[model samples]
Target: MGWNDMQPLLVQATQETLWMVGLAALATVLLGLPLGLLLALTRRGGLLANAPVNKLVGTVVNVGRSLPFVILIVAIIPFTRWVTGTTLGWQAATVPLAVGAIPFFARLVETAVADVDGGLIEAVQAMGGGAWTVVRKALLPEALPALISALTTTVIALIGYSAMAGTVGGGGLGTLAINYGYMRFETTFMWVIAAELVVLVTLVQLVGEGLARSLDHKRPAAASRWTFRRSVPTQTSAAPEAAETAAQETELTGSALR
Candidate 1:
């Protein structure tokens, strides 16, 4: 078929691919982000350390990551069908795509969050901040750039997974390529589809890079270490004690010199 004939097909297929990848990415974030945070926080010495929970969560994430997308989609066919009421089309494809990617994204999130400087957490805690407060103010803000990069990686992976979804009647460019290019021996279709995918991935990568770079403003090395107010408490309840301690220290130093 000529470009005139294929134009509509290409547009529709592209739309479907975007829909699948976008929705899956959203779901991956909704579920994956918290799972990742939990994994990071529940580890030994973390803000909310729990050895048992950490091991269980880690194992589950590992198992989920072990399954390849192709097999994962097939393996979870029943669950997908149950979720979306059909195992065909881009909508249905999102179920498995999100499920497959959640663990992957979560792991990346854990890595990113884990890399945040421990001093920031300590600083927050010294200010009388709880785990939730530290997570919100310290960990997330500091790790945001790396998290964006991780999300970029996950979205790119979803694009590939979307292509694989096409083989199973999950409609997208993958379906078009397989149905027309490979199955029907239309070499032109194969080339065109491949080109489209390349362009799409390139655009995603470029945007992701821009965002990551823009947010990577965290200070380098020792500068990133926030000076924790360990001796003087900042809260209203602790102010009196901090003043008393300061006065006592000053008096001791003068007495020693005299």
Candidate 2:
């Protein structure tokens, strides 16, 4: 097909890729966050620590992460069929994309949550806050930026996975690249799809990084405000005592001189 003829196809394919990646990323986050939190909390000495449960979940996540995307797509064909009622198209493609991404996202969440200050958890507990409260207030809030970053990574990975899904009749930019660009010897079409994918992934990363930076920027300001509030009372309390002591010393000196 000529470039003009291929324009509509390219636009449609871009939309398909975006739709698949966006939905899959959303699903991954919804399912992965709690699962990852469970992993973090169930680990030894965690708020809801249960060693056995942690190990079991860790193992499952690991196994899922270990599979190659293409292999995962093939391996989960039956589940994909069951979920989408057909093992083809962008919708069916999302099943594997989401499935593959959940474990990966969970692991990222685990890492992000694990990095949260243990002291924060302890302080929350000391306040009589329960596990859920700590998780909601401390863990999730503290890990928000990192989780955004993880979602960004998962979305990029899903884009690649969706393209790979094209090989298995999963349609998207990948199908466009393969069917029109690669197989049909249309180099220009292939490059166009490739460029679009690059642009898409780039936009995703930029947005993710921007959000993370914005969140991170707020944290230091908040910490500084808290520190300032905490220190003001100490400084104020000391001023009166210091002034009184100095006055007392002056009085003693004047009396001695007389």
Candidate 3:
């Protein structure tokens, strides 16, 4: 296809890709966050610890996470149809995409929450805080940066999975690449779509990194440490000068007395 002919198709495909990825990411977060918290909190020594419950949830997550994305898409076609009343568009594609993503994202969340300091949780408990309070005030807040990073990684992964969905007639840039680029032998179109995907992923990574860095208070604390170091030398230099001046004054007073 000529550049002029491909523009509209590319635009529509790009929009479809975004729709699939955006909705799926939202679903992943909604379902995964709480599930992940459960996994983290129900562990052996966790606040709500229950060995059986933890093991069950972990096994479920592992099973979901173990399935290959393509196979998962195919395996869930009936469920997709039941959910969206169709199996060949952006909406239907979301079912598998979201399902594939939820466990992955939940695991990431588990890791993020696990990384929270035991001391902080203990402090909260000592202050008469409940489990929910510890999670809300200490765990979530302390792990916000890591959680954002994990979300970023998951979003990027979703973008790739969305492209894979195109192979199954799930409508997106991947579909465009497959139908127009590969099947039709339109190399130029394929290259353009590939470039667009690359650009989209790059932008997502940059934004994720920026947001994570912005939320990280350690950067400011480190900067303050540097400022303290810079100021210390001046104080030390002034103290020596002050001591010398005091000694000189004392000698002058003694000479005058003599």
Candidate 4:
């Protein structure tokens, strides 16, 4: 068929691809980010250090990472069928897509959060901050840029996985390429779809990189914000400024006395 005839199919496929990838990416973040945080915090010398727990989680993540996506998708077919009540279509595709991505994304997140300065964590803890406060005020904010990079990587991987899933009745550009281009021998249309995939990936990569750079560019101001928030005592936290800023003014007072 000509491009005119294939236009509708391509459009439908594109929408399906977006739907699958979007939902899968959301799931990846919801599940992966926390898993990553767990991995980071449970390591030896980490905030919640427990060797056994860290080892267990690390093993699981490693296994997840080791498995090839294509095999993982097929291997989880039963689970996918149970979850979505079907083994085909974009909706069903998300099960494996998310399953495949969570571990991968989690690893990236673990690395990102772990890369946060140890000094920051120490500073937070010295203020009598709890684990939750340390994570919120120190780890997450400081590691945000790297986390963005991790998220970008995860989304891009999801796009690729979504396309691969399409080949197995997942329903998207890959299916279109297979059904029309490869099966029907419509070489020209297949190339067009190929072009579309390239453009899609390129756009996503560019946007992600640009956002990361923007965040990096403003890191100085962001760092100042973190410092200010931590250094200053506020009325709202007067009762338990220990968790946020208990020791902040002591240095200033000591210096003034000198």
Clashes of each: 0, 0, 0, 0
The residue-by-residue lDDT of candidate 4 on 103-204, one tens digit each, is 888887898899998999999999999999999999998788778767776776777778788778899998888888899999999999999998987667
Question: Which residues of candidate 3, in runs, are more than 4 Å off?
Answer: 221-258
Error of 3 at 44 (Å): 1.8
Order the candidate numbers by TM-score, best to worst: 3, 1, 2, 4
Model 3 has a clash total of 0
Please, what are the lDDT tens digits per residue for candidate 2 over residues 1-37?
A: 6878998898888888888888898899899988999
Model 1 lDDT, residue 250, Cα: 45
Worst 10 residues of 3 by lDDT: 249-258
**Winner of 3 and 4 under lDDT:** 3
Best by TM-score: 3
**lDDT for each candidate structure:** 0.82, 0.79, 0.83, 0.79
- In model 4, what is the error at residue 121, expressed in angstroms? 0.7
| The best candidate in terms of lDDT | 3
TM-score for all predictions? 0.84, 0.83, 0.85, 0.83
Residue 169 shift from truth in candidate 1, angstroms: 0.8
Ranking under lDDT, best-scoring first? Answer: 3, 1, 2, 4
